[model samples]
Target: MLNIPLWKRVVIVGLVALGLLFAMPNAFYSRVEGHNDAVAAIEGGAESPELTAMEGAWPGWLPSSLVNLGLDLRGGAHLLAEVHLEDVYASRIDALWPEVRDALRDQRATVGTIRQQNSAPGELRVRISNPEGIAAAVQAVQALAQPIVSLTGVGERDLAVRSEGADVVVTLSEAEQLATDQRTMQQTLEIIRRRVDEVGTREPTIQRQGNDRVLIQVPGIGSAEELKALIGTTAQLTFHPVVSQTRDGSQDPGGRNVIYPDLEDPELFYILERTPVVTGEELTDAQPSFDQNGLPAVNFRFNVSGARKFGDYTAENIGSPFAIVLDGEVISAPVIRDHIPGGSGIISGNFTVEESTQLAVLLRAGALPAELTFLEERTIGPELGQDSIDAGKIACIVAFAGVLVFMALSYGWFGILANIALILNVGMIFGLLSMIGATLTLPGIAGIVLTIGMAVDANVLIFERIREELKSAKGPARAIELGYERAQSAIVDANITTFLTAVILFVMGSGPVRGFAVTLGLGILTSVFTAIFVTRLMVVIWMERRRPKTIEV
Candidate 1:
């Protein structure tokens, strides 16, 4: 009665062989990882004899994918950063100044010369010489308000314009503020990812935490401080028109201009327009290079739109000084000697080679929307991760040995079949992890250990059911069939519930908890297949060959 079709037999054997073959690379993890990296570099257009030889060391047809170790299992840096969303609000209001001034100017007969007033960061306030026209000024500014294009901001306006005493105040509506915050966070996450990726670190975890936070984990990084230094720079690069050069700090430059001291010469100051001619977001490329004087500098190219704007500005204001501001400080002020037609230009300053390179990287990665406040930072040492791996390996071996010995003493040869299936189950788990490129953590190791016990528990249940059926009038073959049939419902129900729990954990938890859920969920699947199908096939084959008349439980 126990028989397997030829196709079914082939399928079972093929799966086991394929799993082992794919999982083989993990045995030589470092070598395989090196091979993979070398291959990637070649694919990325890097040509080197050493990399070619390294790629040749591994077989071309074989799968080179390996399970990535998580921050807990590999030395890394972990950072929790809170984005300063309010910073965007101030900039948003500052940006609206030009439009507001234009709109008020068009209605000059009603609202006389308009002047901006000092207000809160997110609030925009304006005063007109003709206080009687305050109502008209408010109406003019309100014309600029548009409907917020967000699901939660349905039917709500983007800006809230109001008349306060003799001044008109404008602020972002609640719905608009929410939408802006979301966009700011998304932009911040993207820029951070780009910056981290530029360094070519492997398998870095960059994820949004809450509404205004981001969590970053990078493996093999030296410390949290190093990671922070790499990504923490605001890198707000802006180009503004220089009004005048001055030594006096107390003198008022104008309403829309600002006076910033030179980085190299503190006594020297440049009064520059607040609004930028172009921002770093329009940069297409930035590279560290030398200036005409052989000084360290960064050369940048702009996108089509940025180039046109910059080209026009330089053409109209020949010989006028243009200030390059970095994070609110004037880095360089260079006078436009000619109408530069091309989008490419150089930024020269008192910079070392390293500073120039760093600046270039930042410019290429784009500027962050808002500054990030470090809420938490931690460095995980490689030594500690190694110790965890060592302990986990010991625990796994101990659990595996105990299960094998117990199953062998209790069920004899049938237990031997289950043990074989258990070994294959573990292999398949690794194989799946490799194929999917899942990250392995210390918690994942614990999940694997727990799976060893569960794998045998199914066999124990089936074997006990056989022992009970043997007491009836049925023979060995009939009793075995009945035992498996009776155990099916119980095994399926138990594993299904546990699998669902694992899914829930994965969805609700973060970091290590999710890692544990991954292994636990995959273990359930592999163990179920091994216990129900693979073990049954092995038992059927053995029985067909031996054809035992009577069998002991």
Candidate 2:
């Protein structure tokens, strides 16, 4: 006889019930989404009347996880940017300058007085008083070249130190340049991800498009300009010793000093040392606060290593002004009124509360390694997404109705059983998606509709097999058992091939294609389960209860 075991029947019913229960939230997507967002805000210490209302809309014990909507379905910002690797190269080369100068000075007797010769960015040059000492100068500078970890530069020095006339020319080797580019790209992606996550956006796609380019697609954000503004700022904070303060733009600068305009008064400029005493990389925490005058400010704390350097710098430079530089511009040049022992300071400027909060967020998230030049930027509106969703709903409804009528007219009572399985198949897909937090795009919706039509394929094969067995003098129970046994191989083979195709699409495709693959792959799984177990169990129970002598397909 055609019978499912007691444990198998219980498992089949339990799984179906659990799937429908979890998928129930999606029936009211907006209400459930609001409830989830409100719960998150409350956990983050936010309070509002609207949030309470949203939180109460759903039961506290119910599942709130939703299938995240993709950028095409939720509508937000999209951007393509090119990372300026040359900026990183220049910074690395500039840092080597001090070491180069110190190394050459150690051989002062041979090289005489060493003068730094001005060169292009990413290149360092040192000129010696005596041309005959060039060999000793080159040897001293080459000693500072450190080996880098890279395929082409496994053991080779990163510096290409050579002598051009009387000056020792120092530039990054090709291998080091490649390694630096890779590091810069990785760091940029991580920092951008942190910045976006800090704002609490969902499922933002921050990925590297090529060697030098990044593609950002953040769903549920307002605009591409807003997103660019969030991550575009380098937020490079440094404290430099001031050389001089002047209003004249034409004021000459020393070869070792740099000139930057004050953040408050652009007419006033501060000439400062090129190297910083403390950098933002050491910052452990930053928060927005109010200064003594009740003006908006940012308070920052540094790590242990930074605290020692900052304390020493402040103790030694009492009564001297130090410039706080953000992205090369002097935000404030404050005089050290006293010896500040702790490495904690306040940055007070002409800032609104919003600006101070944003500054704190940027500081806490850390700085970008280099600048990003946007090559493409586009913002998609929610209206377009809603329209797409509406069209998809209509298409699914139509296909579902057509399939239901055709199956009912063709297969009679067994057709109704297949329809139930098809409904549960879709419900299980949503449940699995929500459980795993997968994203659903417009193409993903099409996959679900296609699955509805294909969900009955297994039932059709088994029903046809039963018709043939009944014609060969088999009773109802024998025909039913033989039908399922005969159709098992064909059903498994067909779905296995389709599932493999879905896996390949997911692995090889990007963005929307991947979303489609996810839904399609998940649908295949649920369809197979419902067809093989759910529909068969229903058939077996009906046969046991009714014990009909004959059946029609």
Candidate 3:
């Protein structure tokens, strides 16, 4: 056993205590409203009473803030969405086959015609006019197939392909084809989470489900409809010149007339057709700001390429009004007086602060790859979270008490030392969690409970080994030393295997499951340290001080 200095032990314990002290306010007593109010008061050129109180009441410890509570423990909605791979495949097939037909026509390879037939769930059959260039056509199709997960021959000439699960498939599409698949879905979910977080929603859980699915749980979010609207639509934005038709089919009396294409019904328009000069993708940054006219608007800056494009488009199209379209709706039409060279422009519409902010957020998140469909949604209430916390606390208390009683009854005085180490182990877990700002889910609480039970397994092994050594006529101190030494291998082997499984789970799992795995893994590490090192240290000190002739086991 490596002998740790007493001063080193003091420092470790002192640091743990200090961490707990600093974390208390953020963990249990810090009020969100109070923090906000303090900031607002200070901003308004007034002294904040709350700030003064906070300063006075501040605990003197390193700020190890409380673990972030997860949605499951804090009551939040759980959502599961399956990606419409079928729709994506169909769209890809439709788009690609047309290009294929055009290429074939250009090559003059087709002696007859081309047709598409459905083979399997995600398989496509392309009938060609001539069998002469069929190999070349298949090779051409294979080039496009590179972006897809895997392409295999269904029969003789038919091709069968499907995305490889979720992550791999999404990454392949996003990186290779610029096709939005699983990656798009996952990014959309993350953006939505950021948006909700900006709105001060606490402990929201957003994660990717299977391959094409997303699971989101927003705790304490009352505005489900608004959130759905925010998350479900593709907020594609574009700037187009207003095309006007006069009474003579040339020009209208109005300066410039603009039309918007209806998203649902392409045949209809909110306005007449206008060619787009620029799209939102070129935007580098957007923020809510007041325009020169003192109207709430979204001020945006474009990249160099976008600036050049916008400058060229506007310089040529002077006196023509350009309509800013968002999600297929005309938001504003501003006449170009001078060319915008720097790529900075203001979207001045009649907007409230909230509307302007939301618009800015939408612009920042960029356009969604495809239209989104919300298949499932749920909202968890704070009361549910409170209930979970209550239940978890009860379980933890029961487990801890049960472990304590079992240890004391089984091993007498030495068991008491193990129980003390167990208490420290719990403290160390919380301390580490607070220090790292880990989010605690219901599964995390269960992990702690399980740790409590498993922690004793180490001590139990050591105690059993000591009993065996005593039976072999070993002296008290010698038996104690041999017991810990012999049991070390078994204890390490068991914990290491469990730790490996936890690592795997943490890597592969999502959201709450990952939280559970993280806690379990961390607990195992801390338990090993406290159970073996701490317990051994205590036993050594006790033995040196008391020099007991026999140890009760």
lDDT of 3 by residue, 479-510 (tens): 98889999999999999999999999999888
Residue-level lDDT tens digits of model 1 in 183-297: 9988988898999898878678888887999999998889999999889999988899999999997779876777888888888888988778999888999999999999999
Model 2, 139-194: lDDT tens per residue?
99889888998786788879999998899999999989999998899999999999
Clashes of 1: 0
Local lDDT at 243 for model 2: 94
Using TM-score as the yardstick, the better of models 1 and 3 is 1
Ranking by lDDT: 2, 1, 3
Candidate 3 runs further than 4 Å off: 1-57, 81-183, 186-190, 200-203, 245-275
Better of 1 and 3 by lDDT: 1
Clashing pairs in 3: 74-385, 76-380, 77-378, 77-380, 83-212, 166-211, 246-251, 246-252, 259-271, 259-272
